[model samples]
Target: MSDGVKVIAVNRKARHDYAVDETYECGIELLGTEVKSFRDGKISFPDSWAEVINGEVWLRSLRIAENPFSSIFNHDPDRRKKLLLHRDEIKRIARKVDEKGYTLIPLSFYFKKGRVKVELGLCKGKKAYDKRADIRERDIQREVSREFRAKLH
Candidate 1:
């Protein structure tokens, strides 16, 4: 939410299904049409994920819809895009992901300083009970806020 950062898309399902432990800001490689589609917020990443492959991170399942204005050079909507990250950082993330129950997923996509950036989250899968607990907690908080508002008025 800093200056010059414009969020394009967020994967809400990812946050609900997994517990995010850490996040990394990474640059994404994109074609011209893909960038245009992002500017218009025509992207979906419900089931997208990131993986460290051969010492590099690749994002899979991110769909950038075609721009109607673009001609025959449009990029594939489901192309696997490469992520740009420091070598040491990639190694560190790869190490953590190799552990049990840990995985990498894309949290959000945004434009930073006129360039596209991706937010990658290091996450662990949550259990059914855990999700239920989160929902219950949220409801309790909402009730508390409502009661406080009514008391003030």
Candidate 2:
């Protein structure tokens, strides 16, 4: 939302692996060094997921690289980070997660008004056949677009 805010990393695989139904933006609880590392674009969302515990949402498995310039105050690269969200939102997410085969995945990480935020999604795992179908459809669409562009030219 702020002028300086930028998206650092996105989990592109999440869209291919799961069908995301809804998305929510939530703040991340980060240490000083972790924020610095994120600002430097040293973050990964691979294998990162969100879990609801004790009526709160937490981010797990995200890797934030250590700040190279930090002398003595480096945070753990794989520590679980708490996500700040409203109680109603947490409850809704928890309820959805309780359903069979539903999951919460981190889609992307970005900055808003100088604060770090994560885009979380309610997703269901996709089958292998579905992935293949998606690839085929994308190829068809690309070909069609190319043909149309050629005609226009």
**Which has the greatest lDDT?**
1
User: Which stretches in model 1 have alpha-carbon errors above 4 Å?
Assistant: none
Best by TM-score: 1
Residue pairs that clash (backbone atoms under 3 angstroms), model 2: none
**What lDDT does model 1 reach?**
0.93
Report the lDDT tens digits of candidate 1 across residue range 34-128: 99999999998888898999999999988999999888988899989999999999999999998665889999999999999999999999999
TM-score of model 1 (CA atoms): 0.95
TM-scores of the candidates in the order shown: 0.95, 0.94
- Candidate 2 lands at a TM-score of 0.94
Question: Where is model 2 more than 4 Å wrong at Cα?
Answer: 1-4
Clashes of each: 0, 0
